[model samples]
Target: MFLECQNINFRYPNGSMDVFHDLSFQMKTPGFHALFGPSGVGKTSLARIIVGDFNDYSGVVRSEGMQNLLYSYNLERLPDWSSVGKHLEKITPPSLRDRKNELIASFDMAETMRLRFSQLSLGQQNRVNLIRYLLQDFHLLIMDESLANVDERTREKIILGIKDMFPDTYFLYISHNVIEVSKFCREILVFRNSLKAPQVITVNGQDHKLGQTVSKDKLEQTMLEIMHAS
Candidate 1:
């Protein structure tokens, strides 16, 4: 598996309910994978846990040496005065320095490079952040409803473009939109609750060592059912 989590458990401080209880998941293929569930079902929490933002939880999250890149809409941690280029430089690996311009041009973000982080629109922020993360060598990408502000058309365009542009990279896209998942992901995971194992719906043919089977239409339908049920 490219990513695996076992016996994961967590709850907010001073909170009564456990957000996750022995919730486990494993991703065997390396492509675009979409995760969908109703709001506040630990979707964002899981992303934070996987990326090491939440350390209070107990479990084993093994990536097998694969580095992860996390992108989200909130940017309060970022310096408001810093330009997009400067921010990217701060996080970018030295080896990937040369690919900076190429990546910017690919995302059509050359102009935004000079703009301050505070000056860009939400969609522009997402594009710039995504490009910056992609320029570096990362094995896994976890996006937590990061492009919610961006319109459906633009989000689809950028996401599909990234999938086509980087065939080998693995993506875990967390979203509420089923149509978007149907269009982009080869595998879809639906979370009904934190206690039970999420429903796995594979769209494409088995492409990994741990091959499995499912259909796109079926996955979309299942996603809708789960969402409505929740």
Candidate 2:
């Protein structure tokens, strides 16, 4: 197993309501997955708990065959002192230079590489920051709306490229975009409304490949399942 969270129960300090109760989930293998639900449903909280950011919770959060978990969000910013290309080159291993170059091109960031981090738009900045993480060694990455401001077409390309290139890595993609998650992710753990039993529902997604087109019927079915679960 890659990860397991058994009987998780949590409430914030000085807060009135419990954020999660008897919440449990597991990732059986390394692949793309998602934590999805309406706002204030504790998606981010659960992610923090999984990454050991929140320790007050009562639960057994277990991970086997994995060394580290990294979290990335949309609001994270890179240093503005150096050019994006320079920053990437400084941190990337010499052996992975080819791969880094491939990602830059695949993300349609070849032109912006020479510009400073601050010069890029919000969407561009997110992509660059994500590239930095991608070059690093890690077992799992939790992306919390990390691709938020990017256009749909570009975001799709980046996602497909990442899935194709990092086939062995595990990803927990958190996003509000239902169509995107249903179309791209392998499995989605949808959180139900507050006070509901079985707070999380696991649904199989389309998991479309890099160059394949998913039929509308299949995509709609996944979306409907997610909607009903939510």
Best by lDDT: 2
Q: For model 2, which pairs clash? A: none
Residue 226, model 2: lDDT of 97
Estimate the TM-score for candidate 2: 0.97
Per-residue lDDT value at 216 in model 2? 100
Look at candidate 1 and tell me the lDDT of residue 230.
45
* Residue pairs in collision within model 1: none
- The per-residue C-alpha lDDT of model 1 at residue 21 equals 84
Instruction: Please tell me which predicted candidate would have the highest TM-score against the true structure.
Output: 2
lDDT of 2 by residue, 1-230 (tens): 48899999999999998899899888887788999998899999988998899999998999888787998888988798989999999999998999999999988899999999889999999999899889989899999998989999999999999999989889999999999999999999999855898989999999988879899999999999999998
Q: What is the C-alpha RMSD of each candidate to the true structure, in Å?
A: 4.9, 1.1
